[model samples]
Target: MVVEQFLTYLQHEKRYSSHTIQSYKIDLTQFGDFILKTFELSLTEVKYVHVRDFMVTLMDHEVSANSVGRKLSTLRSFYKFLLRENIITASPMALVKAPKVPKKLPVFIEDTKLDLLLDSEELFDDSFPSVRDKLIIETLFGTGMRLAELLALKDADVNFYDSTIRVMGKRSKERIIPIGKGLAEQLKNYISLKTLQNFHNKTTGLIVTDKGADAYPGFIRGIVQRYLAFISTQDKKSPHVLRHSYATSLLNRGADLNAIKELLGHASLAATQVYTHNSVERLKTIYKQAHPKA
Candidate 1:
């Protein structure tokens, strides 16, 4: 199917994450189903009116503006791909405006709780996998790299002499991030242990499975969730919250915004400013707790 082909295009050429491609596939499939049932037309035959009808149908079904907006975004990307490859001459989503979504503050763990999590060995086991898992949490929380970036790390990417780690961010942009003495020690130990594994099946990735295979996204996310569940009770307990914790912690400590932006590999200051709001919210909560009067 053309949709499957496009998904492959995203996977191979665009470097879109599996999670992102799956969302696109689901959105396109839902829209295609709606088109087939209501208008008896395939995706290629969909018009501007039919696209509008799809939006209306989603609204009638009580989908939120944010969710419907995301689906519209998928349609826009899909139709743009079709138009680009000359499969279609025009895009039905060209005139559509997505619904505005309110910004929500990012959720993050507190510094003290993170301290507790790291200090408590009872939170982790005393095996090879547990040692690797402990370092995974340390790298994610300490370095603030995304899960994809972490999984992509090669041994050569770390410069032990300079105390820095190189990571490839979105759009294939490469950035060098500095690591502290603590993370350097952890990486040294991890590398020594990994070298002891069966040299035949060794993978290039820094994080690996029990069999020494490259760690996939789900595996890493499960690792994140497993450790984070012991400390945090937030509704959202993903790897990104650790990233949020990194950025927010820096902001709360008076670190330069642009410096944090560079550490995070954000393309713009606006993208990094959300941490400022998070910091202010944290301050307000502390004030309410410690102040003599409400």
Candidate 2:
């Protein structure tokens, strides 16, 4: 009953995305099932030893440390919720340490290849879907929006007068991102054409399927991958890679880190700093090109 209450809190109060809430639910349910079967204890009866035993069992089953750590995190959140509700006297998940995950630079596609992909008219056909597909690639690379954010975009969210797009991001936080002249033009053209194709349906969603239905996750993923393959050999070739390229390009183009953080909708500077790798050389180039004092 309390677990369900926690889920409700995540949905209504926290405004976590459904996918994220589902992950939390799965992790908590797995732990609950383990406790019930192994120790014959309900979640309220769970203690530090029980938590440790669960972690050991997970590890013994060859579950990655990352997964085990996430499960512990779920428990930590659950116990903290219980404590706040006065359902528990003390928290047991505090003692568990998160496993160290290896740090890796974000994988990004080269700018030159993306340039060729978008500019090469021969690569894309003249059909509306083809044009729509090209716009998708540009939108992802031009805007650092995550795939879900892009799919959820509504026609009303695009403000042509101000050259900005409003994005609803994690936790339902809304942020405004400015678009370039070129991208703005592309969006205008795509909307006109998509509207004609979708029975005047394009006004409902910024991006839509062939039948004019709102775009879904798999449709966007496949479209991004299909077009990205033309230009990038990177193993990733996902919308997020385009997002990485967008951030990396801006940082290289003399944009400030905080500005980029706002553009990417990152909640903190630490999250944006990951894009700063190999910045000095790019900064030097941008400085020489544009800095008056240089």
Candidate 3:
């Protein structure tokens, strides 16, 4: 009941989005279930020792530090809410420390391979699904829009005259991103074809299933994974790699860091700075291959 009240606080007072609230619910529910099984105590009887023991059990299960840290953070927030409501005398998670997580660089497909993949005749199947899939891949690679932003696009969001797209990103924040001439032309052709097939649904959204419904995340990911699996042998073959490719390609071609930061909708230049490392690694490889120091 206390956890339920805290969840309501997160939903109403914090105004957390549905997706975020669902994640919090899952974390808390899992923690609660674990505590019940381990300590044989009800939610009302949970104490600091129970919380600590649950964390140790998570570690014993070989859960990643980052995952454990996130779960702990969720618990900490829940307990903070309980403390505020006077349901508990003290917060158990206040003294707990989250594990440090290592930062990993984003992985991307090679430019030459990506070019070959895009230019391959297999991509031009002339089927409705094939064309739609190709356009999605091209758009993501060209613009670096997040999956949600790409899915949330409407027919009017793309301005062919201005070569720009209006994307709704994290927290529903909107930004304009420029599309390349080639990608614009492809999108125009796809849109024309889509319209002719009566798949517009009158909803004004651009991306849709064969039945004209808005595409879901699973549907989009399945299409991306299928195409990338055919073209790439990399461990990471998803739409996000296309985003990485977009940023890295821009950096490789002398685009300014600040420009890429704005285009990618990154809150900080530091978040955009990772691509610089990718470019640096590429330059180092080129130098080693072409230099005559040997």
Which of the numbered candidates is closest to the native, going by highest lDDT?
1
Instruction: State the lDDT of candidate 2 residue by residue for 1-294, as single tens digits.
Output: 989999998899888999889999999899999999999999988888999899889889988877887888888988999999999899887687766766778888878999999998787887778878988999899989999899889878999999999999999989998999999998888888876775454447788877777888899999988888887777898889999999999988789999999889899999999988846656788899999999
- In model 2, the runs with Cα more than 4 Å from the true position are 199-203, 278-294
TM-score of 3: 0.87
> How well is each residue in 1-294 modelled by candidate 1, as lDDT tens digits?
889989999999988777789999999999999999998999988889999999888889889999999999899989998999999999999889877788998899998988888888787675679878889888888889998899889989999999999999886779999998998998988888888876325678888888888898899889889888888888888889999999888889999999999999999999999888988877899999999995
lDDT of 3 by residue, 37-144 (tens): 877786667777888888788889999998999888888888878888888888777678877878777899877877787788866687788888889888988899
Candidate 3 Cα lDDT to native: 0.85
Mark the 10 consecutive residues where model 1 has the least summed lDDT.
Answer: 195-204
Instruction: Judging by TM-score against the true structure, name the best candidate.
Output: 2
User: Which is the better candidate, 2 or 3, if ranked by TM-score?
Assistant: 2
lDDT scores in order = 0.89, 0.87, 0.85
Q: TM per model?
A: 0.86, 0.91, 0.87
